[model samples]
Target: MVFGKVIVSLVSLLLLVGVVFGVVAAVRSRGGSDNKNDSVSSSMKSVTAICQPTEFRDACIKSLGPIAKNASATPKDYMLAAIQTTTEELKKSLEVAAKHNVNRETDPINHDGLEGCKELLKYAVEDLESAISMVSGSQVKDINDRVRELLNWLTAVYAYQSQCLDGLDKPEYKTPIQDGMVNATQLTSNALTLISGFADIFKSLNISVPDLKDLKPSTSRKLLEVNEMGHDNYPIWFPAADRKLLAAQSAGRVRPNAVVAKDGSGQYKTIAAALAAYPKNHKGRFIIYVKVGIYDEYITVTKNQVDVFIYGDGAGKTIITGQKNFAIMKIGTMQTATFAAVGKGFIAKSMTFRNTAGPEGHQAVALRIQSDMSAIFDCSIEGYQDTLYYQTYRQFYRNCVISGTVDFIFGSGTALIQNSLIIVRRPGKDQKFTAITADGKEKSNGINGVVLQNCKIVADRELFPVRFQIETYLGRPWKPLATTVVMQSELADFIRPEGYLQWDKVNRHENTCTYQEFANRGPGARTNRRVRWKNFKVLSPQEAQKYTAGRFLDGHLWLKYTGAPFTLGL
Candidate 1:
């Protein structure tokens, strides 16, 4: 058995070497064309021009110029060659990683890391192979589609190589496999850069390509125009009357329409009573001030209560608590929140919503929001699982503290959360991992996503045993097209290197989920070990801007009315 294993390893290594050498030889042999025509030299210059704009310019030119030396080589041929070269380099790196003796029994972390790298590299190879096949098959009729697909596949290959290295960056492991990964990453990055320059190449060759244009209104343009409308530089989305109301509230010049106190100090004691007493279908803002006390009642702001604002003394001082949970009450997840807001333009401030079901009672939601243009500020949502239910429509959360275990912040809404603290609680014995979000955007055209900007993700150390190991996942797609982006955040060490998780072992949503992270800092901000899902991206500054508060939720048009402070762009 040992001899057979040795033979298999040896054969694999030899096969990897042969594949690399074959491609290299094929490239080198075509270094100079036999013909001396001016047109042939011009085509060679086109290839050089294409490589010049790449990140690894010299390496790209050296590797691809020979492959493009054939006077008959088309843009598709050059792209295929670049992808083939990238896949070959990844295979070489994979072979090197396989040589390491990563035993799970002795060194579980490193072993898992190595095994994960192997899987990622294998996926990288497959991505590139698929790209090559697509280009060869002439399946894509549109030039724009072809270019986009090629760029996406090449980017995936580059990202996968980086992910492999990220998984290996641990104190417990030391291996020469990193050297191969470094080279492979650079090679794939160059390939991606070269592929991205295809438009320029096509332009130079006088090849017709589709006009690249963006039809959506620019966020910067909207910001500038919107700012012009407000004298105090407030968001243009807020109407002058609403702005006056906010100014009045800020100056303490406005009185509440109704007051609710647990004691008999007010006409209405419970929050539900206050809502019931307030006139229904009111177009103007109706303010309800709840005094300091734990209002142990389930509250619902129905659809008829429009533009309602609920304020409390403070988050911890004025609490709303319930014990309903899916496990104990046999309720559906959406119906399990202690507080449910179903109206439009609902705003809440300085209050705590709690589900007292504890960790054993799973899927206990503290707050459920389905209100369009709803905003929560200076609030605390505490529970074990499914804490804050962002059901649908648009919402914004600011300066809030949310503590939970699994899918703590979730829903199908297009929500923007800024400057909030996300606390991942220690799981119960039955739970193995914690997921911060489970977005359910099911359609490609739906402008529904969860964007967490400048937030902090921390673990609840007090809930765990001494030296207990904890792994937190950023999110998993509840629906195939689910989108979530965490940008400019600080992550605690408890966050796993993989960043996001598959929905399940069997019905994995890895390929279709749009999970991304950008410019986040901290020990868990590492991106290399993140899943190599087809749509997962480490976005550029330009791309990340699209998911900012102002852009993602169209905050410039609505957030100002809620009186929640937010940044206009990333």
Candidate 2:
């Protein structure tokens, strides 16, 4: 029996090596192209077929040409080469950004932005590395098998490679930095475009996507499950955090790994100190119980700190506040987050994250969560503009309050907010309108959007009476293919009958965007007077479940264990 198993393993290993060697032959064959034999041209031509579909064909071919050896026709090999090439190119950009960080011209003003670019590029490197791992693995066959998730990560790479320049104060100052980052940007774009147009690439190679329709969510859910793990060993109070977390703590049911209090009563006074002591390679959730206090500091939960659960006294009492603003501080919008979560499986409850930048602050963010499978419950996110930046990956929020003036609850990620309150604050002196969300899902195939489910939208006391004077819109397309769905929610009367405003009145992205409201109630929910955009629709019950927590985010696979109130489907 052992001999037979060993034989099987050896056979599989040989087959895997055979597939990779074929591509390796192409890299080796490039040097021999000058020989002009039919074999050499065919070898090079076969590789060129892969690059033909990319926008930067020459760059695409050249990117793979340098490191590649010999030849193989497997699409995965070419993709691996492309991803690796992108990763290498991004490292160059990171070096350039680091040099710019200390440059005298960038000394005071552009230094922070340059530093931000370095950080964003580092994130891009991680995304590229993950891409390389995804395709290089033995389990993945065609990129098409995991294309949905691949697009999400690759799309993020494209976004991050350039967002650093977007935050620079001077338009002309960006040209040099943008030029330096263009190669990685173009390569990232090629990888994303290649995956997006994989079917076309396959057709060019005279083949069809294997078992395309047979692909199931269960299989993809399993893939998501691999990157993250959680235990259902939460105290009884966790499931109903707002109602029972405090009581459970008092009852000695909740056991936390660490305690942070402002009065120095606990083991740590600062949340940062608690996070600094995060155990390496620790299994299961590391719970941190924060006592009631108004802790004023900028908090960043870095990527290495995974599965850290922090529950505070309450949103009203235990507040994490910052006064960072873009216009005032010159820190980029991406850097202005009062609280940022870049880790995986981060959970925060009963806390208020507030940015006091006000409307004039222009893009100040209260909470920016890029954590995969992160959940925020019973919290309040307050800011004047750009309050909640759900940057990427799948996220869940429930029973929270989010208030802002412009593009507040916005992000380019797959997220669901259930039973939450959205307060529209009065705009700054220069601002004439208030937009609630700016959905940044750029690709049509990308699994990203902000879905507000069973929520309430209301105007704050200062803005309620004057709400009619200021055009309050549900959302505007932040990207060409942006998407947002407000399902089974209550939209107060102040929201305009037109529902949504155009991102650009002249260009009007509504024709290309997806803005939907399904079974939403209240006076503003009536869609009779709504803008008849090309993709806007009132979805039927039959089509609603696809956007629900169970299907949209595959929440059932993970949410069940979070002890949060969530419906698997409509």
Candidate 3:
């Protein structure tokens, strides 16, 4: 809705995360930046112009530097340099954190929070690595074509850093960590501002941009490879066994690596025991199958547990429930998750993760996932507030049921919820509003958001009768740039005509948050009475495509490998 001519610059800034310092360092080490166009005055003028529109203008200018030797650097080069420098800065600070390691942290809460911060930093680095790979591997001119992907990854890095700082809420440790993060955070702000100001920056600097062209994959890939393997099925990355297991009609046909049964009939009696039994240096999918039972425990699949696949009998049948919340627990909101997944390639199917914390429990979480390329299918995540923390990275929730009262679905993750049920439950006696989501996007162009595609939003049975008296909304912006899209979804009539809840009475988030609806139906989907926020809109087909599961998620590339069904486009 807010598309501007400077989209070129926005896309370019996104790729800066990993390349900023790396490119300059590479140029300085391997070859001097003595190109005809990269003159001292030109570089300075360009830096000034680019940094002018950035939030952290001083940091942007300082980071770009007065390097006299790099006379031929482009705005893109400076962007990359800034990003790589930021990454390095974060790394250096985290490296110092090694001395106050998780193993040595005395307080249990501090230990968990510190571990989360450290792991989040690693994820941020991973995101930066991806950005670097995208920029460094491809032709620089092709950057304009990968605008969405670049935005997606760059925003992920921002989310990672925010969560790290926010998660390290302990006052004793917060000050030092925040002081250490000053430079990196500032650079991040500058980079986000640069994303949409490319055209203006180039114009001011009088830089010549190459003619745009459609990107094409190498011909060798077409001839030598087929993205689909096993007769138009799994991707090449999916092993034969894994593919076979997924393709099987029934779970009975597939044998798992570990089985969890409450009756002690299986290899492990508890889900925690089964997870703890994970083999070291696990290569392929490590499967853990849980039988029907209510498991009352808090489980976290740590960063070291990669490629974990945990499936249960069914959503309600095999459940993991907990009662931790901000009201009753000393831990941070990040620590209140009943089941948290920190490993990559995490898949949870046919399971129920619930936080039994009542509405009074301010920030209870059912599930918190920081795993990249993760999928939750046929699952049920239910709670009153802060139910599902779709924290960061690329995530997908399909054919799942997520029920909550306020800000149930929240986080800074690039997430897509499709073919799912989002239930608006009854609030506590004093609670007046029911909010379904809170997309925690701090940066304007960062790709972290919640996209509800082909899903149903309905008030729960208990709440439906009283929906008229209570204010029920699709969501309110949790951060300045919070984003959520309801596309091709059904909204029950109980939903308030305004459609969205305002973060405050002043409409402070009116112009910043990106809230949109595309081809949504039902009485509640009527935009006639929807809030008239500047950033809210009824998206067109082209604009809606950007939020689809396929395009928004780039699911075509890796989702096939995971055997999760996904649509690529609207």
lDDT of 2 by residue, 312-394 (tens): 88898889889888787766677799899998888999989999888878889999998888899999999988999988888
TM of each candidate vs. truth:
0.60, 0.81, 0.80
Residue-level lDDT of model 1, residues 1-570, one tens digit each, is 000010111122223323333444455457644455534454455556556666676777767777666766544566666777777888899898778757666655456567767866786787678777765665322222243334434544554554465456464343477777765676676765554443444455464444212223323323223433567556564556567778887787867889998888977889998999868556568899999999999988886787889999999999999988766665545556899987778999999999988878898899988777899999999998999988766789999999999888988777888999998888777888889999876544345778899999887766545213656789988877789999999987778888898888886888888898999999989998988889989999978877876656657556766777778788
Q: Give the candidates in order of TM-score, highest first.
A: 2, 3, 1
Candidate 2 Cα RMSD after full superposition onto the native fold (Å): 7.6
lDDT of 3 by residue, 1-570 (tens): 123222243344444423433444554446545666654453454456546777888888788775423866554565567667777877865765555654333565566677767867777776676676666666554344344455656677777777777766567776777777788777766766665445444554465444222223432222112343547365554666666666662445657889999998899989899999899987678889999999999999987898898999999999999989876665678889999998888999999999998898878999999887899999999999999999887899999999999899999988999999999899988788989988888876565788999999988899988888998889999888889999999999888898887787774686788899999999888999888898889999977877766556667566765656777677
Task: Tell how far residue 167 is off in model 3, in angstroms.
Answer: 4.3
Q: Which ten residues in a row have the lowest lDDT in candidate 2?
A: 1-10
Model 3, stretches more than 4 Å misplaced? 1-53, 66-80, 92-119, 125-153, 167-176, 191-216, 220-253, 505-507
Q: After superposition, how far is residue 427 of candidate 3 from its true place, in Å?
A: 1.2
RMSD of each: 18.1, 7.6, 6.3
* Candidate 1 accuracy as TM-score: 0.60
Q: What range of 10 consecutive residues in model 3 has the weakest lDDT sum?
A: 217-226
CA lDDT for candidate 1:
0.72
* Prediction 3 global C-alpha lDDT: 0.76
lDDT of 3 at 292: 99
